[model samples]
Target: MVVLVLTACPAGLRGHLTRWLLEVSPGVFVGQISARVRDLMWARVLELSKDGRAIMVFHADTEQGLAFRVHRHDWQVVDVDGLSLMLRPHEVGGQSELRPGWSSVARARRARRRK
Candidate 1:
């Protein structure tokens, strides 16, 4: 199985993809094709996608049974402990200033509970 997601790409590139894959939704394509064909399509996408971004996920023999490739995307793919992960782009600092589950309301509730 193969999944191709495109963002801000040209119509020509999308049209070229539709020839081999099914457009499950706007900018999302899914299909199963030979590796050679998939590579060829990816090449065409790179040639025609211009400044657009694309990500392709496909079956593989890896531990997760899948692999992915990204082009001109902010997010990055990383490998850790033999697992593939998506790494979000961080701010200028090494960590993000904003933290999850630390909303003001939550903080107020915590303060009341401590009292």
Candidate 2:
């Protein structure tokens, strides 16, 4: 089974994918197909999704039992200790940092760092 999530893509691209996959939701597609076909579909997306982002998740014989790949996305997919995590893009000017938590101590530390 393959699941594909697309953002900001052209309608034509979505139409192409709908041929092989079901458009379960807007910009979301899912279906069961061979790996080769999946690759071809992604390649077509790459060619057509000029200003879009896409992510493909499929079953694989990996430690996590599944694997995912992202394309043209702002958020980054990172692998750490056999786990997959998503990291959002850092804010401009680095205003607020994602620290341990919003404890009083954490707030105080941020204030101290500014000084």
Candidate 3:
């Protein structure tokens, strides 16, 4: 299974992706295709996503059941000890500066304690 999600992309790119995958939602596409085809589609997506964000997730043989990649996005999917996790982008100085929300600060504090 392969899934690709696009945000703030152009219409032409979205149409092109629709040809290869089903448009389950406005910008969400899902399909099962060969790796070669998927890679080809991703190439197009990268070329056309300008200023937009694209995320692709697929079934893989990795330690985690699924593998995911992001392009031009503020969030990222990371593989840690066979578990897929999401990490938000932070400022260069420190993450605390970017996460000003009380909940995020608390969560960060807890994460620090765990470390």
Candidate 4:
């Protein structure tokens, strides 16, 4: 088994890429999909890119089953034979700062430091 980490700068694109890969390869791959998907995911991502969307994909190899963590959330088990896992922003800790009032706390901390 292998672990792959995929990330997209923009949140919307991430979901779009993820869905596209799933549609193309089904359970064959897992983890976030982005503009890099084409080169990283190889032919499969290329087929999905025909629709035209910037995507990125990363591949990592693991000896055992792949586990995903995004935004502190554990992803649902996706049974695929290869060594890859797709992760959404929220699933991989990318959305950790998106919580309600997080910005306010950060601002307050910054203000305190400045003082």
Candidate number of the best lDDT: 1
- C-alpha TM-scores of all predictions: 0.81, 0.79, 0.76, 0.24
Tens digit of per-residue lDDT, candidate 4, span 15-87 = 5545544533422334454535444444443344343333232433455523332322234334467544553
Candidate 1, residues 6-115: lDDT per residue as tens digits?
Answer: 99999988998999999999999999999999999989988999999999999999999999899999889999998888888775366675674579887887788889
Provide C-alpha RMSD values for all models, in order.
3.8, 3.4, 5.4, 12.1
Candidate 1 regions off by >4 Å?
A: 92-102, 105-115
Every candidate's lDDT: 0.91, 0.88, 0.88, 0.42
Go through the candidates in order and give the clash count of each: 0, 0, 0, 26
Candidate 1 clash total?
0
Give the per-residue Cα lDDT of candidate 3 at 63. 72
| Candidate 2 lDDT by residue in tens digits, 64-105 | 878888998867889899887787877636665555557999
TM-score leader: 1
Clashing pairs in 3: none
Runs off by more than 4 Å, candidate 4: 1-44, 51-61, 67-102
**lDDT of candidate 2 at residue 74, scale 0 to 100:** 67
Tell me the lDDT of model 3 at 50. 89
- The 10-residue segment of model 4 with minimum total lDDT is 1-10
Model 3: how far residue 41 lies from native, Å? 0.7
Task: List residue ranges in candidate 3 displaced over 4 A.
Answer: 90-115
Which scores greater on TM-score, model 1 or model 2?
A: 1
